[model samples]
Target: MTTSNQKPFSYIAPGAPKVVKAGGVANLDLPILNLATNESSFGASPLVEQAIKERASQPNRYPDPASTDLRNAIGETFGLDPDLITCGNGSEEVIDGIARVYARPGDEILFSEYGFLQFPILCWRTGATPVKAAGDGLKTDVDNLLAAVTEKTKLVLVANPDNPTGTYIPAAEMKRLRDNLPSHVVLVVDSAYCEYVDDPAFTDGLELVAGHDNVIVTRTFSKAWGLAGLRVGWGYGPAEMISALNLMRGIGNVNAMAQAGAVAALKDPAHVDMVRAKTDEARNKFEADLKQFGVVAVPGAANFVLVKFPTEDTNRRAIDAHRHLAAENIYVRSNEDYGLDDYLRITVGTIEECDRVIESLQRFFAA
Candidate 1:
């Protein structure tokens, strides 16, 4: 007999199918009204489709290792220098790259209580320790995050308008945390949901990146651009930080089709604006509609709402509600893994999609 000491680190991935696959019925529902993944209610822009089609015949060739054209387009669109942008397969890769470059074994990577589940996985991937600060009512708490930092904390990650919970930290508060943090720690602002933000005071952290060597802002084409399948994301930061990320990035991390599609997606601002306007309208209406059932949803600026259910014990109501929706093939996000058993995160879909849930939910809550 041989004994081995090899074990893999733990990472719970998002975007798992919400179909109840245990019993045959769980997976048998048809035409799932998916409000689970925070995918854009609208699909990709026409330009992106055309751009991808233009490059479809060249699959046999290797893509540009550095994503030069894509970076140039992003730089011009956002007024950032290409030198400051590092494109990745998705913002997830950019984030993981940051962990590999900055954090070593036994080093500490810090984030908010409900920041992103991926943060822990990234830390584990780099053999770094994960430190979490308490949140303030589902929102990232700046003071708590600042208080949790220690000398060994090499990287600090904050997801503005964070996932699952969908609560955001305003620009002033975000700045306060940055100002208070020691200069040695690198702060990563994952602004995956920034385009949906209507708050004038909210920032995607570009100003912070403008001067701070220790600050980097990560963005994605997934949510607002409706390019989740394309897996295109970029980071804007100091030249040195971008350089380090590029060094750690895999060859052709952003695929050819992804690069072409993202560039095209950027050229059409009207499509994104329409998505933003429509999402805002749907979200506001969804929130108001839930109130009729005495339910309160977290006012999230993203394209999703974290709806809370009245529970007597063991989060029974929320779990039951999830199953009830599941039976009807209407899938929304269950936050049990995020320690939010009493809440379900629902993506704001089209008016028709949103309407489907209301009647079903009324039956659950009223009964």
Candidate 2:
């Protein structure tokens, strides 16, 4: 009994938590130590700024639709074939393209229990069911994910060095996950925070993609490169997967400025190394300081730390701490949306910023 005037299907709106932009608060003349978003404290390279300025004069011209030069630069940096790469406004856009190309209505998209929030949103947009596999203390449990797989599953998204919790599995575990999955299923390895990890055991999904046609690895310039404002991300996969993504992605999705900035950013390895070194120093100190206050900081490989409050009334403690920090113009992400009501995800800031946060927390707890 379908009515001619009625819409075909109901639109499922996203119910995720509101992302707080610390910049907005900082703009109000507040002395804010903004750490909500996991952006690089060091800022984008000088080369990136110069590139954007250089490209500014050509604002009227359309970007290269194929993102040819940018792709080539990325491929050169990673030692991959440019033909197997596809660029997007952000990795999220590429994820959307993957869903559109590979997932159909009645299909399922699978991810870990506390994986990236975008994974489920992408699934809903593509009319696919989002399935959650249980995790082991915020870490992706490969066995749980494999067990959750059904014949209906079309895509599996794994955010290595995952956001919020910031945990990751080793390369061998990742390989095992890929090897066990059905060949028809596409496995997307989201390595947004890969550059921050110095772990020898970790792999950024390049090796898996080299041998497996069903594997795709997505990276972003938003993290260590500090080009988040430009929204540039790229994916490397088998030629067939890249082709499928390119077909669904909008032409000129990556603008001229972003392309130029990304290319320049890639050429400066020293900038990235400096940012990583600073992040490691700050993160270690911050964790140690928090532990002195009885806070259990999750040992993660990413640039952000997931801190759990030690109290029976965990949620209240977290909320109180958050409000206290906000009063001092310091911001951190509350994890209520990710079923982690008792924790806060704080980005690793500069040394002084980290010290300031630690000092503020000490006062809040002492009171």
Candidate 3:
């Protein structure tokens, strides 16, 4: 059935994101407060700007394909071996490398219910089926995930402090899942939001990889680091695994400016800490405010909180509230794609911005 001009069956990908956040395209009378993508309310460290300014002049040169300096900076911050770290455009690319290296047609990639939306996309990219296990409400159930593993399952993905739902399983449970999984199957722990989690029993997945050769942990600078525009992320695992990822990762995936900026960002731990504290404070206040308004909200460990709207009695449903806020030039995430039609995920913004959303939603509820 294959033809010279026809597309490969494996080339299909998921549709583009239904919500567009850039460009301020939506016409509104008020100033835009774009929080739809969970970007950091605080900008990156001042050092990052300096680094980018210096690197921007050399646009003619190619980046270091190995990302040596960036990896060294990451190693210094995390106490990891620079040799075991592999950089990518974002953690998404590392996930893609993992998927392509381990999976193929007829194989399955297991993810938790309400897992990160990108997991299915990566599965499709590798021509593997995406299998989801049941969860206990919004939290990922480790036992259900372990039980769902079958002979065809090649990889398992767990996004700690999971996106959208903003829930995370403790380290003990994550280890249990890995212990029960087959030795040949790979386990990937995505810790994109780890900087916001203060749970004593939770992990960013780095510890799990130390003793297990089959485990890889990925991290990103997009959240608390305030570097979403830079698209810098990395993976830590065994040296052999890192080698395989380098082969699959596009050459110079992380550009020269991203590398410099990420390196500078790592040097300013105080800035990241300040951002985390502020995010936590803002998220807590948002959740409490919603509760005061008789709106159901899920307590979260990440930078965003999920609020459930009353769908039965009023026209002020989640989608309606989302549009109402957007019309006021305040955008929050709507979760229709994740089958969470009744919920909205609000990224923690500055106190003033969060106050604006609260006021806007309060009016929506009253009207």
Candidate 4:
């Protein structure tokens, strides 16, 4: 069944979203709303923008491979040990680094079925077998995950405020999962959307990383910090592990501009607050509107809303609605690849963007 035309490996999706390929702005035929990726609609922080502008003059020089200054900045802000942090091109690279460190042929990399898309892909690409546990109503079933682990399991990944679904397992549950896992297993808690959560029940993975050698918490400036374009993300773990990852990953991993922008973004608390407020408002409105239309909405702890439509035809309806919204300059993600064919994952945009999507949805369903 092997085909010569096929590439030996394809780690990413087939192609970009259709709307992106077409040159036109959001239209009926070419609607341009992008709720596909949960990027911050608020854009990069002003502090980051100014820093990037200032740093732009020195692009010719290679960036610091160690990223010592940025690491120190992160340590100062969060009280983390600077040596424990490893900055990467993005969280994806960090995940790749983790896979590279822990995985080999016959090693098992485990994550929830409802977890982020990249975890399994990274595992497969690194020669590790992926063992997925079924989720409970879009939330990761910690019990199932623990049951699936075996002697060959080397890594376990849990994304708090998981992607597509935006579901979270509480701090107690996390502790339970940690206790249940073997000490040799590396736990990766992806808190990419952690900044949006106000609940105290959810534990910050940073705090957990301090006590556990097996734990690594990965965070990104891509979400609430609004630095998606810059592609800056960092991983926090035991110093030895971080050192190993950096060693294998080589030097000059993070660029100067990204390092500069992330430092400024971390310093700008006001920007974080603004993004948090906007996301809360938009998510509330989007969820309420979906409920009125009889769509089943899973409880979301992140900045996006997960709504399940009535049937697989709703997938088409969602696509049609996405096209209709693009005509009105709005966009959302259809979760076909995630096995939720009847569902859509809508990122919380600004108030106006939310209104545009809501209005477009109303009109589409009405017609």
The C-alpha lDDT values of all candidates are 0.85, 0.85, 0.85, 0.79
The estimated TM-scores of all candidates read 0.91, 0.91, 0.92, 0.89
Q: In model 3, which residue pairs have backbone atoms overlapping below 3 Å?
A: none
Per-residue CA lDDT of model 4 for 1-367, tens digit only, reads 0012221122125642443223565344533456657778787667887998999998898888999989999899889899999999888788889989999989999999978989889776888898999988789999999999999999999999899888898888888888889998999999899988888898667877776789899988888888776888899998889989899775888889999999998888788888888788878877787766667678877778888766555543655655555455455677777888777787777777677777767776776
Residue-pair clashes per prediction, in order, are 0, 0, 0, 12
Off by over 4 Å in 3: 1-27
- Per-residue lDDT, model 3, residue 362, is 83
Cand. 1 TM to true fold:
0.91
- lDDT tens digits, residue span 1-367, model 3: 0012222222122532222223545444467676777778788899999999999999999999999999999999999999999999988888888999999989999998899999999876888999999888898998899899999999999999898899999999999988899987899999999999898999898988887789999999988898988999999998889999999999999999999999999999999899988887787777778875667878668878888987785677888787677666676778888999999888788877789999987887777
Candidate 1 deviant stretches above 4 angstroms: 1-29, 313-316
Q: Write candidate 1's Cα lDDT for 147-194 as tens digits.
A: 999999999999998998888999999899889889989999999999
Q: How do the residues 1-367 of candidate 2 rate in per-residue lDDT, one tens digit apiece? A: 0012211111112532222333434222446566877777788789988999999998999999999999999989999999999999988788889889999889999999999889989877989999999999799999999999999999999999898889999999999999999987999999999998898999898889877889999999998888887999999999999998898899899999999999999989899899999999989888888888788888888878999987775434886787677666677877787998778889898878889888988887777
Name the candidate that leads on TM-score.
3
Task: Give the C-alpha miss distance for residue 312 in model 4, angstroms.
Answer: 9.6
Q: So what's the TM-score on candidate 4?
A: 0.89
- In Å, residue 193's CA in model 3 sits off its true spot by 0.1
